[model samples]
Target chain A: MANSASGESIIRRFITIISAFDDKHTSMSVAELGRRTGLPVTTTYRLVDELLLERLLERDPKGNIQLGTRMWELASRGSKTLGLREAALPFMEDVQSVVQHSTTLGVLDSDEVLYIERLGSTSTIVDITKIAGRLPVHATSSGMVLLAHSPSAYQDMILSRPLTKYTETTLTDPAALRRHLAEIRQRGFAAMPGVIVPESSGIAVPVYGSDSTVVAALSVVVPRDEENTAARVPVLMTAARGISRALGWRGKLKGTLRQSH
Target chain B: MANSASGESIIRRFITIISAFDDKHTSMSVAELGRRTGLPVTTTYRLVDELLLERLLERDPKGNIQLGTRMWELASRGSKTLGLREAALPFMEDVQSVVQHSTTLGVLDSDEVLYIERLGSTSTIVDITKIAGRLPVHATSSGMVLLAHSPSAYQDMILSRPLTKYTETTLTDPAALRRHLAEIRQRGFAAMPGVIVPESSGIAVPVYGSDSTVVAALSVVVPRDEENTAARVPVLMTAARGISRALGWRGKLKGTLRQSH
Candidate 1:
């Protein structure tokens, strides 16, 4: 209803302002924010003022603006992700304890994998996943597991797009990717070695929700040379099952039963 | 810039809409949302439409609207809370393992204790702390530790307010609380027995940031009957130091050093 002269809604401009900040640029001066968001200086100031009034944005002692704790609280208090994260954390810890590597819980969002919860390790693995960070759905084991369980039409939609070959082993050909997705569904997990990063391998299994539908992927990142799938997959599978049960998943429907080897 | 007929800005209305949903009411019908937010039907619908366009809100299969994953991602991606949470989690896990009870990391926000990261245990200690949930500053050990470390002006402002006595042990007298704050500052920890929930006790230690400023509180909840502060405080203090170190905190300032008992 509140469209600017550019025909963009206020919400769009708000999103733009918030999106200007990332992990690298957690705080910035108003002038820098205006430049980064590409909004008119006056518009940026006005929106920032309103946001500050509501404590949706705050200024540090150095007068640089950053996202407010209120924003995080409001977003988290009612978020479905919170419930999923709470349900998965304990089991993810168990997996992390055993794997002694980075363990992450990710969901398919916006055609990418959004890591919601990640327990990092002291290991020297070259894992790049960060909480709230995104990765291509075709280049990681978690993404592959999520994509394999998604509806076929959605898979087709993703496969139709040009995929980036991040590493030598990354599958970019749609036919090959489709075959791989089918195999992942059949095997109930995905183990991709050096697909995104040359030094790390990701092993992931699907986590089901109350409806027995795949809701997330619980995964571990280990050294590429140590792709011990037999030892790792069972740990992930067991933890994923625990998470699924915590989320009220009553087990798979009879006809859709899948086995993990 | 976009103020409604009642003179509330679009951002305020947006906050109202989002705040209507919470852990207990994660999703709701549009009409119910309008009623809950107390915004006009038309305004609610329009804002909901815009928010849906940005994927800041999503509808469940039952046509009920809830906070979107994008909202959580946006709030988390650049949030200071995320970094603090990440730094605290590994140590929080260790504390949880030993305490075998709920461990929480909270920051003082809007004059209350807002728990950012909590590692829940299987113990039946009656912990009321939830991630993103808030409790009054006077009754929570996390809140007291935070308040104790705060600037004198801020502490005076809080002390001037009419404090709620949640339980018989909750200190509502400004003079008593001020004295208690001094004790907490001197002792380097705050342990309140059944101050909020009658059955649970909270032992909290201040977690410092790089500047040696207390940025958050690391605490554990235990049964009131077993108020083992001697054993619990050291574990919390150890974990808090680890978290502080992870946050780049070196140690206390030379002249302002305090001892933990």
Candidate 2:
């Protein structure tokens, strides 16, 4: 809770340091870390020293600091993300084996779709989804499925924002997107062709929790020209249901499914 | 890095709060967190407030706090664990599909086998492996494979310690375990039947990184009575090589394999 002279808390500074590491930028020197985090040299070194001492960060053999295995362990040991990923993996594997493409399980996090687990070959399609990677809510089938099941207020809040148009098919208009969300809800799935990429299509279905609330989006990426919506949707829906069941979700009664604005 | 009156840094306290949650206790009230963490009530409340402010922890509708999605994202985005898991998952899926058992990817962390990714039917076997769960280095097939590939000094350090005897079949003797490690290295896999759990057996092979270093242990847990080491070891070795190649490992040249300890 202690605030630095610049009015930023130690936690915020810590977050800045941790956020500097991504898939491509996994390790760097303390000086580079300070520059990336915009923290003072002394402050960065001090914080890095603390984090290293706590085993939250580690120095590679090359002496560049990287996120430590301990940090991952601490975050994952009690994480709901890990729980959901574990429950969905077998079903995802089933889907991947059948579909022969990338299958991903994503959840709504910080207003974006954060992919938690993915399987299948990377060479199959132009799939950009990665574990812990985020994509725009409007440009992804997984995002649309999650948004379609979200509360009307949250949906409105998301749609009111300026949406990024990633491709020719990406719907950026709020009204158009709302209509798409309605269709997605009514159809019980979202199939977007070339919304994020030009050569691939994403089909996603809602995976529910014990309370019958949509907890994640189970999705698959396939070649855009080979977009077998009707065929792929069934496989996705089946796998989603299995994952939902694994999460303690009983099948919804015939009429209990709710619609959003 | 400042230590409190108790001589513990805030980072240590942060770890304590996160460590309080596990597979069973994913959420808890601040009061209960204080009790579990053994921190003073005021300190717990203060730290909890800070964590919640940063979205490192989240409050549920029932007022119970859980590890936030941000924590998972921050921990995962720059993690080598995620990178390793991603690389090994597809191959592990292939192994799991064929083996029809629990496939796990483990790495040496804190002198134990920390399972980072696992797949398969939990109902099929008495598998103690959970994502983010730890097992003693000597009691697990994955751990033994990792230990066998590690430097002799590190192996000596581990074998010199008092190891827990989890089952009657668990080899705790330094000299005997050393011989077994040698055999595992030569045989190219470890098939430990009833080493940790009497109802289950573990089969493991080493996964190599780009530099040809033993990066992880890929394993499967099956029923002890159905231990098919002859058929399973080859499958594991094949998949481990696939995972290693994905991690940028060039093919191992003939006669390059070295024994440790």
Candidate 3:
């Protein structure tokens, strides 16, 4: 297993090093990286040297190490994320243009809603979603749509835990949440006003894969006070169907029994 | 340095394993992976075990291993590519909508053009470009714009090599290419007709970064016989300026005195 003195595998340490970086902390000194990763100085330096030699990590103009283009290429060249994003981008553009707000594509990953692609006016909205960013599965419309389509057992497990309430309107009770999930599935989409942010509301519909399983949530974020927010649901549903068809989904949707043709 | 028995560091081996997968070859058996990476079977098995432990690689339902979501998340969460794509996507969509062709954003990486974002009709044109794909610097319009902005020393070094002639229009002669670069710099754009492929042509303009340096090329691909291709240059240039402004570019471009506002 190649365990070090602390009985941790080299792979574990590698994850620790890479996970220390994020959108906010894209680059840092080696000493700071060691502190964030909680590794010994010697081990940190040794591993970082090896990573740099392979160009998985690169030195910035300021001499601080950051993620390398090579690493992104290696990870993305064959990723399913790329294929999904490619299938969804054109349709997302249509939604964004018509909605005139933020359009995002998210998927359920490890019990959290991970945003894979987003498009919209960057500075004109109170939207906080970012590509590659994560949010709790109970606090966003995208998350609710995904959860509503997941297996009942899995949904129960997720709801069994305490959910964080980001706003006064966020539903934290397990029974109330279950009823809401049922409503979402029945309506063929989820619309939550001020669930996560009081100034923005999210509306999301499920995107399907070739196997007729829910693969992603196609959503848009608009001003909470926009009284006609419900009118935007057809635009989102149409775009979601387009994306689903692009992914080779041929069967009718589970609840709506709707076909793209 | 943690060098393995073959005198290569573990990091190098890690890269070999990851690089073995690409857009075409996403998953395979361990033995197939060993063959693709040119590594010993034992080393491949051991290293793959460690990688699976860290969730950097995963086994699909059919028992084939492929790159993991965690690997993609780690690489993308803090990538400079993400930032550039975010700044360029909205404007790229506008260009794509107007041109009704394939619009792409690419950056010069390792002396080649690497496309980071692409949009528009995917099936109507003979475009060979894909996100995460690379093309020769001398055979692409985007490459020409990047080369025109690069330091003369770097440009000279690239032109000194034997360039591949992908099509009859590809410029392989160093002196001819140098003259073309000068023209691209003077005109603030590069248009290559059937340079790499016979059926399509590319037109590109340079996008700037915060420090007012050329950081990317925004290009559109159109049918080679379309004489109106020149008419699209203004749209590309306008979108490029918007992207440059979004990146915080304020100073005048090196060759052109035009500003976005």
Candidate 4:
């Protein structure tokens, strides 16, 4: 239980240190890490030393500290996300091959859509999704699919919050978003045209788990001009079903299939 | 700072708690976790509570704790492995497609081969490699390819170890392995027939980084009887080069190309 003078627990400090790194900042010196985390230099050095000793963090040839292979291994070895990602990968590849667009698998987390896997395309689509990147749940097709499938209370919690208007088509109004969510549920997919990026459109479908609950969103990002919803939706739906089956989903359950009063 | 009376550091205890959960044991109860980690019940509960509060551990509906999405997100967001894996994925897909077998990307970690990414096949080849799985360096084709390009001192250190004879073909003698490694270095690939599993063969090629040093091994596992090295090696080599280029490797440097005395 290492607590700083600021009354922050060691775990919080550890998270702060780790969170200072991202795709753009993969490695840095201890001084820079301290500056980024706003932790005292001594504390940063101490925590980093312990992490390095455990091989959770490694120093490069230049002595810049970075996350270690052991860190990724420890995080991945028992992660449920790994199971979902593995289940979705082959199917996502198939969709990518057929659609010739970026295929992504995302799950709703912490009120946002966190993309877990993304297969890029050589096409000139303006998709901004990256692995481990998060986007607002109200703006992305994957987010809409996940939001549509979420429990009503959770949906209300998100809808009641002030939403960012990323694009003209983004559903920011609670009543409008609620209606759109219902429509997405009824249609079995969400196809948003330039909801976040003006040049691209994302089409997504729900991937179910063994309990018949939506566990992820299988999506494709294509050019807005080519908004081929008719063609793309079927491919995503098929691939999502394949992934769901791989995740041990035995179709839909009869009890859940019954209409709510 | 929260070290138990046993004198183990808090970080070490955290690692012990995390290491207790793997692919086979993705989730467990607090009592079960205590048993698995061999930590005191109170310590386990305290750590688990802190981890849960940080969203580093999440409880399922049944109250079994599993690795959290936040943990995976944090580990992945700034990891150098992500860049390497992403660079290798498209090429690995190509190798997996053409070879119709399991294609893997592995790196040298802790004197063993740690597989980072694996594209599985529908083929009947017995490939024990899994993402985040580790295998003996002397017994895997990926390991051999990586070892061949490693510094001479590392090669000496590994060859000095008591190597396990996984199969009749696995080299246990240091001299024999040294010769084989030289041949692999000269040939630009490693093809091991039934070195680990009796029914399969693995062929691997090295992937380079921006610094022109060997960073990873790209491999495919095929049926032993169908070990078509001639055709498969070219495919693997081609994909490895593509991945290397994607990782910013500008071919081999002139100084490195000079023969080492």
Candidate 5:
């Protein structure tokens, strides 16, 4: 490898350029990319050209560059996300078919609930989560399940950190959140009502892995006023267990996030 | 933009580094990455270090790095794949449930079909195609379906380029392949039996986009001996149409791979 500071610096800048394209900023002009990455405009354009040549980032007919199918190809293949999502899909679809609501699989990532997969009917609860997207662990049911089953170090990390409040009902108090997480462990699920949004309840349970570690969370978002959503619990648990079995996690399974666990 | 040769050169190396991660090589040591990227080992290591710091790549317990959740997050959020997959999922699932094999959604990229999604069942046809993987346009059913409905420019581009044969049955002759593509257009679907492997067959239908252009190909991999797999054509056609409708394509749709005059 080159020891040239310049070579290393360019790689850092390139990563920044790549990272600049997130959920809100999928396509960007060369100038915009330079600005976002804090690289010189000329450098940005040159890198953009190289990326385009390699098909890692593609320019549309309009000339705005977006994540190339090749970039997606390179990043996505042979990934834990791919393997986990494959095993989780059938069961997730089953839950979505029955519940007709937002059914999701999430894992603990940096103390937040990173949703690995989600499916819901059009008429069901409007969810703010996306696949490969993250939401606060203490503020969502899926988060709670992961948080509850996670090592104490993770909870301490989150509790010690600043908690952003999304709704009035979000448990910002560390003691309260700790108790709630404990309750979730005891109840085998987390029922978070009015935590992330008004009139919505997120119910999530642990998805175990081969080592019996809580590796993921399976959850559904329902209307806060709905009492019938409880019947969905057994179905979700069964589906979660099925995914665990597929992954060869047959221990006194705790929970497994479908991906990146 | 300044035309700094140094700037251009560095950016070029960066793309090379990212491109090195593929289905066949998901994780590699910095020395290995340097060898693949043709960059200096020190350069690869230093840049990879920065990327590691940014969470673009995470080190495994073995101290080797793999693509990180951040990469997946940035690639997935608000990307076309999200909308495209969301639109195609129900149909893809529908196809998989009945076919109980490898169901996939692929789009044309760089004169090849890049599979963005794949759902593989236990009894699925064994193939090397994985999610975020590519196959030659003339050798794959999905690629053929996409190419059959594509513009003349794409046709000419592929024709001018040498067609790499994957199997003995693959149509490598330009004239024969052109005719094969035309028939796929005529039939409105592509039945590529033994095109890739002897024991498997691929059936694909074109999936349309907002302007009614064939933007994708939805296909299934089934056992070669299963004549009943032909029944999957109607199911796939229906699913393709559903996805196309969702993508804003509409008409008294002819649900086939053919180009209408």
Candidate 6:
């Protein structure tokens, strides 16, 4: 029998306390964590102290707990994200230099677009995402690129669920979303105007890896009035292919690159 | 009374297990972790499983455990390192472009060099000091700058003990190292030839934070030809000051900057 009721697995409680701080909330006090994890204040304090001692969580100047540098070191020292990020950096720089707007990197994390990297001019566009922040899978252009190429099960999971809309153009209806995803797949990129934000149009292309799997998405946010959506698509696709090639994706991308052989 | 032994502090054990993998070893098996952490096999397995469940540790293709991206996400999302690295990035890129060697950003971590960011040509260097990896305080140029600018008590503590020697040029004599520190303080940069490696030289300059405290060391590793030593010193100092200013260091740095404000 699993000892779910017993306080034996402090690790689960530890996770519970941390998982409480999602995109909406990043910093929380001890009492807040206790209430969120439903643990006693004393136990939360003890475990939090332990985590602080281990440098897994840090206390800010205001005494709020935040994730620590040690945790980042442990996670990034040997992660798939680092390899992908490293391979993508040069090409992303190329895209950012050319696009001269906002170039962002997003990967699917639990049915949402978890942005790993984003580069932008300070006055370019009203960006909605932050590094390591998440957005809905059906509302953002990068999300649509990933969703269109995702497995059928994942597609059904999102399509069957109630989709939240950010703006009037956001594809909240499951039928409309399915049609939009089809168009995205057909065009090999997603260009959604005023979907996530009113003044921004998002253009995104999927990046493949050595395994020929869509590993990440490269996206740009431009002014909604910009008529060069098709022009930006090739630039993004080229950057994505460059990143893919850097990651050992030797196979030629469908319309993005010229055949060498 | 301490009811739980420090050994049972699974969090501490988890840190120890992960920290065991350094520049030398990036992956480890359960058995190796047990040996390194001095935990039993079953305990190692259980703890590793817990870490895996939390996505703090990842399994490589060979079944060895390595650090995960979730660690980087948690560590970087709200940490000062991200800001520091972000601010240092453009200048670091500038330095990497000019130096074309091992240009790294290292911070003071318990008197040793804990490299936070490294950018260089992959084939330019023979050394493997990595991000999050530590080097001896006296054996590295960046380590020397950090140790020199550190509290006098830390210097006493380090010098009161044995000084390690990696190469014949390594400063093992405490009195000599003390002299070297004084010189570094006077010159505003530390340049040592063949200290870490026989055929290499490391030029480092201190990077100050908003509080005007030296918080990091920016260094470049070059082939120890003595011909490029003078040429590299100004470049390293310039990059260091550029990063320092980006970090909000308002103080003037001598010898590193050619322009006078």
Q: Specify the highest-TM-score model's number.
A: 1
Q: Which candidate is the best by DockQ?
A: 1
Instruction: Please give the distance, in angstroms, between residue A238's alpha carbon in candidate 6 and its true position after superposition.
Output: 2.6
Which candidate order results from sorting by DockQ in descending order?
Answer: 1, 4, 2, 3, 5, 6
A63-120 per-residue lDDT for model 4 (tens digits): 9999999999999999999999998999999998988879999999989999999998
Model 1 error, position A99 (Å): 0.6
Give one digit per residue, the lDDT tens place, for model 3 in A1-261: 655878877777877888888999999999999999889998899999888877788998799999888888899998888889999988998898889889999998778998999998668789999888999999999999999999999898899998999999999999999999998888888899999999999999999998888999999999999998889888988998899999999957454454221
For B1-261, candidate 6 gives per-residue lDDT tens digits of: 122354356566766777776545667888998898787788788888988887777787689987765665665675667677777876777787788877889887655677888786457776656766678888888988988888899999878887777788888888999999998987778888898789888888888888888889998888888585767777777777888888888866454443211
Per-prediction TM-score: 0.97, 0.95, 0.94, 0.96, 0.88, 0.84
> Which docking band does candidate 3 fall into?
medium
Tell me the interface RMSD of model 1, in angstroms: 0.5
The superposed Cα distance between candidate 2 and the true structure at residue A59, in angstroms, equals: 1.3
lDDT of each: 0.90, 0.89, 0.89, 0.89, 0.78, 0.78
* Colliding residue pairs in candidate 1: none
What is the TM-score of candidate 6? 0.84
Return the lDDT, model 6, position A62. Answer: 78
Task: Give a tens-digit lDDT track for model 5, residues B1-261.
Answer: 223334445555545666777656767777888887677666678778877886777776568777777677666764677778888987888888888888899999887888888887645467767778788888899998998888888898988888877677888888888999888887788888888887888999988888778889999998888877667788888888899998898745443433222
Docking class of 6: acceptable
lDDT of 1 by residue, B18-84 (tens): 8988899999999999998888998888889889989999998888899999999999998999999
- Name the better of 1 and 2 by TM-score: 1
Write model 1 residue lDDT over A66-120, tens digit each, in one string.
9999999999999999999999999999988888879999999989999999997
DockQ of each: 0.90, 0.83, 0.74, 0.84, 0.48, 0.41
Per-residue C-alpha lDDT of model 6 across residues A26-106, encoded as one tens digit per residue: 568988888987887887899899898877788866798876666667656656676677678768878888888888999
| Model 2 interface Cα RMSD in Å | 0.8
Off by over 4 Å in 6: A1-8, A16-39, A58-66, A121-123, A253-261, B1-6, B16-68, B233-238, B252-261
Regions of model 2 farther than 4 Å from truth: A255-261, B256-261
Compared with the true structure, the alpha-carbon lDDT of candidate 2 equals 0.89
